[model samples]
Target: MKTPACRIFLFPAMVCFSIIFLLSCTGQKIVSLKTLLMGMTDRTGITQTPSPWYKLIQASSYDRKSDKVGGKGWFANDDYTQFSGVDSSKGRKEYILLDSDGPGAIVRWWMTFAGEGSYDGIIRVYIDNTETPVLQENALKLLSGQLLAGEPLSASVSPETDLKMRGHNLYFPIPFLKHCRVTIECDSIRITANSRKPSIYYNICYRQYEKGTKVVSFSKDELLQNAELIKSTNETLKSSGTISDNLNLYSSSEPISAKDSINVNIRSKNSAISKITLKLSAFDTEYALRSTVLKITFDGFQTVWIPVGDFFGTGYKKTTSSTWNSRVDDQLKMESYWMMPFKKSCSVWLINYGDQIVKADLNIESSKYKWRSNSMYFGASWHEYHQIMTAGAESEGGTGKHRDINFADIKGKGVYAGDAVAVFNTVEAWWGEGDEKIFVDGEPFPSSIGTGTEDYYGYAWSRPEIFSHPFIAQPSGSGNFHAGLTINMRYRSLDAIPFMSSISSNIELWHWLPAIINYSLTSYWYVIPPYEINIK
Candidate 1:
């Protein structure tokens, strides 16, 4: 007895209800910390169809390149130069870092000031040539390690205990439709005894896209509206381990003699190596852990060769503790969460090069993984320097030629993931003034350069306090400059360097004093297939 229009509406509404019911009967969408981490590494973000490229606008006041003979484009110069605010008829209150046409996003923002003023400056961001700022807040609170009370903001800070001290890092994505302008306002005060004005050091990294690309400008109102989703993500990141019931876990225990190699094989049609844990039981547990080599041949490629201890950033002796991607405890247990994907089969071998009878236990977990054509194989390599003497002029950015600590000499298509370094400082005034130089795609000079060793690892001013973050950590700090071994590691979760042909990554062996030091490094990367590589 219903009207014709009412009957038609009821039919469509019932159909919609049935669809919703069926979806409810099935499973709802699930998002987790792993999902967020995986999205950050999505290579699809690298566009090429219409040809869009990324650009970085680093406001290094004085040109560091002009100072060095063959220096990278944007080298260290902030220590020597001061950024004066934009002058107007009224006064100078803000310093413009970026004033560009966009369809882009500010990916990274790093700032550390030398002054009596606390880094409690204000930041103003304008989008689409708007007179009013889209985002404005206190710089310190905006990018603090501690959580804020208001709407959730996308940012992070390094460990407070790091010896290099406070190097403020902000990773909020500030996208713009047409144009973007950024400025910082700080009080002028005496910073150093020699300097009269407050000086600010900064590096702003951004990505520019081709015209007509769509971008959603940042909005505080939108963030406040969706605070629940942000809360969920924060809670998920704080939780540990897999929350799914479908996870597959496997374990194996075997006794290995000196020079004995034990191989653990996994055969699957379409699967991946998710997680691995290694534990050693021997009379000389420390020696066995330090000398045992982990070799992984996935789909017939010798992509991994590293000492187990060094792989976890525990060094030759266990003197510290950490819990993250690679974790080690006082009980001599090590764990790795690096995902290794394979199609036909994958094998992991533990080669004991030391003279010790050890009982090794290996636990592995696997899950279904969708392998794409452009997806690369996980790779790792290790290198060591018995005793490296820091000498001559050039190493300290002087006239003499500089020497480099080669982390990796890779060829073919790949992305430089991250690295771990362990140093035995003999006489330490400070063992790491060295800057990182990464030459991409066989360029004559390095395309990517950094300020200092600790800055590259996400801290500042030569801080050596122990800290552990999701992506970077300092497990050992030596407590003092000349104490002993200090180990630090960083894993690139949001910023992995990609190369088309080749990449040569090195750290200038620059230190305060000409002291001999023992150095060891493990570099991790991802490479395209052929299952073979040149050993350079």
Candidate 2:
């Protein structure tokens, strides 16, 4: 029940008068990990998807196996992943749907032959500078297809048809392609329908944001009293006393809500303008967005700014804004970025919460100083539109591609020691199939539970897997990547309260599994802004 955002405006809001801007540069910290990849200072952006990714493929090439019994998360499934009877020149195993460097418009697919009987193929499309136009020129209005059986099946690019299966399963409404970058090549195959001997399922999901077209969920009387106001500044702390006092939860401060328009691009290639200490700790902590803890203190001054760090993206959904005037464009998904060593002082943590701004206002970068622009009073643009135009794609609401929420850098471990926590992963899990029971800060470390090896930074099961003559007490930062990587695996959600449950955790399988239950394990930990102790 949240949808209402479509004003368009066209383009006519550029008001800025400036008000004493000047933070050129001057302070940084957190240097290690071989001096942050040897260099730092980078910026990249790209998110293009207006139509060209329509999916619907389920095969059953005559009796092998087909079982999806029952499961619901992304809401209904008809099973996918059918490159169809393969061998069409053996091509199809490429990803990066669209990457100006990283943000949205992604593409990462693998294979999975469907079942039933008669497999086919032909779904390959790619375009970045290949001259645009990858699909939809009028292949019967581009394409529109749909099929729906019963029980536990569903597919829809929506083209409607005729068929029913009591409550067993079968639904497909596919055959409508509208956003770009497509691929589905299986032109000749037949599965006239059977029973127990056909299998087909495809799931590499993308293109979502249509729950009323996106206004950015918010309706408890529109929140805002300061929207739930939890601002707890200095409630008190004393670090060299070693520190302690009125600590309802050490130090805290809350005043975030940007509305829109925030682009912090800088990968380490040496863009100059060092000295940056930005800290935004959400107070009273319990699980303030996965576990609240962001510390990015960058002042290093060697000209090394390394953080193209995969352009930051991979599951982030908390985009909502129904009636404040209407808004939707908070697409920020990142899984890597925590290395500050120019002159030194680096910390990271933006743990899911699209359309953000929680006590920000750092903007202290300088090779000489300039950007903070918008004139100061706030507002600026010349508009030629060549490139660099982020925030878009998720379908309707924007900024939410399925990532319940997580923000950690527990370099201190457990209940947070030095206390720079912002841990808010109400729940998460990754490794599946036989023998795997993980329990960190609480006791039990059964050795990461298997499956932790994939090469190019993908599947992870790092840590956990403890046995053989003792050694216990891990968690100081799990096993340090650059000296960070807390331990988590909850799968929580007992009747709402995963922060309202965008997808708090509901996936259990002793058999059927996709990408090992969507996403089994992917770890990330970093802190530099200032977890405490003179982050200057």
Candidate 3:
């Protein structure tokens, strides 16, 4: 059963109202675009679970036939042109993409289209019980950085990708108070499998707040009001490697021989790690990148264990990419900007498991942080499956023996930050037909399930062109359609999932062909103490 939204808020209704009034003289707190944009870069905000926490929900164009577990058409591939209902009350028909009652905010919108005349439709967003649409623009232009906010927040992946094959994405937050409806007025849409009309695909992620929570609905006026802040936020996200002057830096250079390790310890009383950078040199740089493991212990508890490459989003290769949380440069220097809080002490280690000696230069930055009740320690976990075999999906003529591969099974209260996957395909066939299935707080069914692996990574059509953004990136895509290496990563801010107890994340290994492949997953998160992580 779905977790009731009422049970998520522990405080009394009066307390919720009090907090809102504290933010403004106007009795209700306005969750404006500025409020959400500022929250995106606030590292400390994610640690403290909100008093009236919001649940992350996803509305996607997944195959409707997959509604029941172990039912027929569970693995159907017709994930396009599905609608909630058709609204024709206004004299013209509008296909409903999403209709929900809200004290909520839409955080991420990813879409793509195929067939003829697909990208010409106008997308309308109606909010707060208003009959007039707050936003009405060409669907492609609105999502692909042409209509609203520009690059990173609103973007299409891989400039090298063919225009029609690219996945358009918008990360700008769209808050609503009473209700929100998204519809499309496209005459070219047809539901028939063989229809010549365009096929639309989408995955919309939103946050549903508890009832009675005050939220300011999105509008053109709000967008105009927050224009300057939006630009500043985009700048900050783009320059994630900028070091803050407030932080104290600790630098070290050491050579670790085969089967050896080096450590850096910070014994500050009330401090947090603001940034970490590491550069490695070896005879075989690629092998060293994969074999050298980065391990971190916060306040006596080990919380992070992953390879240097995967942890930094490069995945065994020194590919250049940048995001709000992590980045890799042309010189192969990798930096991580996750805020890791500690009460008294923190320890970081780099262990070389390979035969070659590796030289490492590390830079650690820390700043004063006040310990709070909701403070959480940052964590990351990674594992690799060698020579894993995949059975083709039945839709493509092979046995549909796809299986869910666990990324991370975290036990304890925490917020899921982000994840990255590296694949080494052994054949030149599309290997990412899988969908992400994430279960939070021991829910009977996954609260967040995706349409496809590529869709979940904010891209579409399995195009191999490389792209980079502040939140999502494909550092390398050679393996996406051929037998090579591919790396896909996604970082979260507004859409970060907070679990009161546990989170289990899995992605189906739905390869298109029966082939052997190498797959590795790295998951990033933050959890309170007394936590257990299944990946080691």
Give the top-scoring candidate (lDDT). Answer: 3
Per-residue lDDT of model 1, residues 1-536, tens digit only: 22121000011434434544564465642122222223443323221111233333333333344345355533333342344346342264676666768766665566655555646556677777766666666666555432222211233334455312476666445566578877766665343545535556555655565555444454454344345655654454333333323456777799888999898888886667767888888888878867898899888888998888888778777755543356676777777877777777888899999998889999888777667666677888888877877753444544333367889888877777789888888774677766677777776656556566776676666666776655667777672277487787877644556666777888867666666678887898888764334332
Using lDDT as the yardstick, the better of models 1 and 2 is: 1
How does each model score on TM-score?
A: 0.79, 0.24, 0.93
**lDDT scores in order:** 0.62, 0.20, 0.84
Clashes of each: 8, 146, 0
Scored by lDDT, model 2 comes in at: 0.20
lDDT of 2 by residue, 102-148 (tens): 01121211122334331333333333323222331211111111111
Candidates arranged by TM-score, highest first: 3, 1, 2
Q: In model 3, what are the clashing residue pairs, if there are any?
A: none
Worst 10 residues of 1 by lDDT: 2-11
Q: Which stretches of candidate 2 lie above 4 Å from their native place?
A: 1-78, 81-110, 114-120, 124-536
Q: Tell me the tens digit of each residue's lDDT in model 3 across 199-313.
A: 8888888888888777766766567667888888877777776455568888889899999999999999878998999999999999999999999999899998899999999
TM-score of 3: 0.93
Residue 162 shift from truth in candidate 1, angstroms? 9.7
Estimate candidate 1's RMSD in Å.
Answer: 9.7
Ranking of all predicted structures according to lDDT, beginning with the best and ending with the worst: 3, 1, 2
